[model samples]
Target: MQKVEVSDRDWKHLLDLRDKVHVPGSPAGSNSNPCMSLYRPLAERTKPFVLAQVGQSLDGRVATPSGDARNVSGSDGIVHLHRCRALMDAVIVGVGTIISDNPSLSVRKVKGPNPIRVVIDCNGEIPADAKFLNDDGESVILIQADDVDRTINGTQAVKLPRRQSGLDVEDILGALRKLGLNSILVEGGRRTIARFLDAGVVDRLHVAVAPLIIGSGPNGICLPPVHSLSEAQRPKIDVYNIGTDVLFDCDFRHQYQQT
Candidate 1:
């Protein structure tokens, strides 16, 4: 984390960075804004570039005990999330997020083409009228187990081998990559992000922390228990302050995960 805080003065530069996000030789290559730093590496990828994003409270709660996670992140954080979606080929979430948030998962906050909206529904739980599945000019993919036979109308289903954790992450990525969705965002509830992290498939992790603290609720991440701290992960991280929240851009590739 850099000690110097990024303020409103950097907002225009940040927006400029967002505009030319994936262009390798663009002006973003010469800039030092945290926005440019957060995404430049993952941009323009030929292979799979998986990024997991989460918006949580200070104490690391994604939602309250009552499941009220409506706006944990303020306006700025919300825009930042949308900016992330704009840069990716697709934005992914689990069925829980669909049932709870019913997010459109489109690039409404920024001026960019919308990415494919994907939902993981291993148990055939998502409804046909789910917001993500609705047509909004972008493609939508539903990932499920092969035996689940059911389909959510209008979505392209990609069934993979189901494991104890869920559908295989590698197969999911492979299937998505085959469709040219190389840059993926795992935007979700806790378990889905944890599953990807545990699978060692995530390349980067964007954790946007809002100012307020939720004393008790579901944690942002609930990974498998490790007896000792030595077994824990210590990825290289970069920090950015985008008004309402602090973004921790963690580089998991080559640190531990197989990117």
Candidate 2:
């Protein structure tokens, strides 16, 4: 990836933001700052790619203590995520995230073309009334592992062969490419992001760090042994400030190539 230098003042701003956002007291409190731990620069690539977009607290918690979405990030941060989504070709999430969050995964309140909604449901058990199934305008693609009933609620279903673990990342990417998706935004729930990072399939990462710490609960990403931070070499990052939040945009092209 190409390199661009950030001014010293901007770098200091990022460090300061990271320090202030991670409050050490209550789960619900103001003055909490979240920092996006992006792994690469955004303007250095020119390939069909994947962008991992996530929101996390100072302590790395992606959700509230009870898994509720009450205050993962403030209104500004949430809107920022939607804005990023508006620029991508598609928005993707894992099956677990779909079941838990029941998110529409669309770009709302942002002026841009609506990205296609992509769900990685290894199991063919998506709820019949899931919001994506009935969403207007945005195309929904459900990647499942079986040929189970596809006539449910007018949603498009793409079947993949079942494996003990889950959907194959390579096959999924290929399919997305076939759908004319040049860039994909992975709005994940930990496991999915970790899997892609571990597989070395991610091209870029866009993390929004809020100035608050959940202190505990689920993390933003979870990788296997091989993809552990200690094992995998660190990628480059380009930091940007949006509102009171810090955005860490990272890319990892030197270590691996898209197959």
Candidate 3:
């Protein structure tokens, strides 16, 4: 990958935002993360600049077994999520998110253009009357592994390769980038986030830690077991507080591509 220089002004803006949100209990104080040195300018690269967002409990649970996760991050976190969505070219999620939450996936709380809603549905399971497909002008994409003839009214079903784990992340990004989507925000329901992270295609990740702990629930990222701390992936992270929630901006590209 070609090295892209981050503009001084953009860097300053990010630093200002970081300083503005630094609170007593934020994780930005961590001095040991290896990914910090890789932070640089945000530029147009080979693929869309992808950022994954997750709002979970302190213990890292995103939702209960039954898929109920409303109000976990409070009002400020919701608005912040919307703001992130507004800044991206598209927002993606797995079919599980659509079935469980049936989220409209539009920009409501914030003032900005609504992103193209992309759903990774390898099995063609999303219902015809799903709420995500209800919007008329908004772009919605449903990706499947096979060339299934079934279709939803407003959803554009595209065929992509599927792996044992799920849909191929590389192919997904390539297709989206070809469509002129330069930036993508992945809003997830655990499995979808795990696939991207496991594939190592993720550039940035924003994890919002709410102030509560749900002892028994679905985790935010489900990875293979690692025996030691040294075996763990530690991206450079910047922490900020959005009301009662603490947001961790984890930069993965810098950690992985450092010379």
Candidate 4:
């Protein structure tokens, strides 16, 4: 891992570089660009951490009227998405997203060691044919609520019972921590991201805001209502523009203190 304390000027330069390469409505070229170069270094600095990466439309929608993947973001954004996968120690998503999208959740374009694939299946009911169950490049861990038969190939299944309203976020994080993963990336549909945020577990947030607007669809986050309006002020983000996409970089520690 590259070791260097990043200066404020370095952060500003990185943001400028991201803006130049993360062009909206354009296909990312084959060659490495300013965005990748800038992000690669910053990602290195965020070791033993967690980052929440998500994409949403201008109006805060992550899907189409009928839940189709339509115009979420251009190829440039997708390329950046892969960069997140390459940088983190592991990738996490809820079972609902796994069943709906059937994502292989691998780092394809960028050449780097693939992170461990994690599925938050509260009920140990992942379908036998899920791609992560068969992928060879990275190991898969299914976090569930019951003892599942460990006969599945290319996957390690573990059980962690739900606490209160949903799967215990603290337990899931503990398990990831036990696996020697210092950093984790939470890639999600909606409900999963919300759970992480609501549980006060997400350490950072990287929201890629697409230019298009989807009037009605699944929200990018489905957080439970805060006990009161005052309780909702837990996350205060520092925003940066990546071309048309806005990245909301937040540190939950500060938010927790403020709350």
Candidate 5:
């Protein structure tokens, strides 16, 4: 674990955050808790913790129709992302994100250890020359549905049962936990986030809304159809301003889960 020396101003900000944090049994509004986790399925409490993040435009689009989505969030938002990546044991993304963004998924902007990179490539689609496989020291784990055993450029491939939707999330998490990972950050394209959400296994959701709006593009989360507002999800949100972007840090497990 790395130790950071907080400045007085940062310390004051920490003090101010106390009232902004909210948890189920905690005070109505408190941000004092430095760490927050999603409510795990009873069986998954022993599994690795999971958190998902999304950066969308004001109109809820992750990318434009042409599949261009670079720098949707400002530098501050980008830094916030790297910081979050810096704190996790591993960072996960769907194959679609890799094809679209070709993200390095490393903690370059922040001062912390780089985490294990997890890619959900159910099909064997990722090209052999993918940049993620080139990182010499960083650990890369690819979850694929294909039964053929294979390895590419030093990347370890974990085979799991496949569903029409994608690789089995439960099996994926189980494999990750078995690898000794205690926490994971799920950062991705829409389908990936949807899988975790539909599974009801996500513990935390961090949404950073940029100031711009792209009238049409890919939506962030593809949830099931709901008949009325009463059935809609109402998460307990903690708001924060990261430069020009606004963050909606939400804990869905407590608000939506039935005890």
Candidate 6:
């Protein structure tokens, strides 16, 4: 990934809005700059927030069949993700993402504090040296099954009661809440984000669509089947351009189900 482009004056507002991202919600209106208009919802959070993001091709493929996803989002999408990480209190991923991408999960592209790193490893499957576990003075929480006695260095092992589907989404969120990580970003592989989306806990979803089209690859999202158009989710959407990618910011705040 490329370093943060500080010279993009159009999006320079992002560098300014990175830290001051949460205030009480206000009436909606469009701003002249798409950067400000697209990011307004994030700053208006009045309660705990959970959001997920995915970058894919126009054909909806996140990676080739061989699992080569490097540079799929291009430079701008990568920068946007780093900004999101800076704005959130914590960033989460599943064991699959750790094994596949080995992401550092830090706000390296922008100038801001790194969010606490979190991993949902139900049975302690991720290796100790995974990049996400690299100690940077910030907290790291490994959510595993209560029966799993294993622990990882550079992390606070927080085990919760597991359910049939690994661990219940509600249980995981509750555990994070007690740790004071309110603004959460579920930055992950498709399965993990789909699990959270299916649980109806995600407050927003960002789908950044790139221009490339890989005919055979893993899709950006795979959720439980919805029979028809009416049965599907119809979120309030705000569109914006981030370089060669088009971002569809889907607001699901009112759709979140309280536990």
Give the TM-score of each candidate: 0.87, 0.76, 0.79, 0.76, 0.81, 0.86
State the weakest 10-residue window (summed lDDT) of model 2: 36-45
Worst 10 residues of 3 by lDDT: 33-42
Off by over 4 Å in 4: 1-47, 147-151, 227-229, 256-259
How well is each residue in 1-259 modelled by candidate 6, as lDDT tens digits? Answer: 1112233542344434444543333222235446556664554445788889999999999999998989889788988888788777899999998898888888888766788998999998989888667756578899999999897776899999978878999899999999988888998789999999999999899998888989998997899998876677878777777776788888886443323
lDDT tens readout by residue for model 1, 180-244: 78889999889999989999999899899999988998987889999977788878887887777
* Better structure of 2 and 3 per lDDT: 3
Which pairs of residues collide in candidate 3?
6-41
Residue-level lDDT for 207 in candidate 3: 89
Better of 4 and 5 by TM-score: 5
Put down candidate 4 lDDT per residue, 1-259, tens digits, no spaces. Answer: 1112233444334443333334332222211443433354435543456778788888888888777864496555666677677767789999888787788889885555578999887766678888777666688888877655444566777677757675788788888888877668899968888878877777677777788888998888777767767666556565555554665656676765433
RMSD list, candidates in order: 4.0, 11.1, 8.4, 8.4, 7.2, 5.2
Q: In candidate 1, which residue ranges exceed 4 Å CA deviation? A: 1-28, 135-137, 254-259
Top TM-score hit = 1
Question: What is the Cα-based TM-score of model 1?
Answer: 0.87
RMSD (CA, angstroms), candidate 3: 8.4
Global Cα lDDT for candidate 3: 0.73
Tens digit per residue, CA lDDT, model 3, 184-248: 88899788988899889888998888989888789888877889767788898767655667778
Provide the overall lDDT of each model, using Cα atoms, as 2-decimal numbers.
0.79, 0.68, 0.73, 0.69, 0.73, 0.79
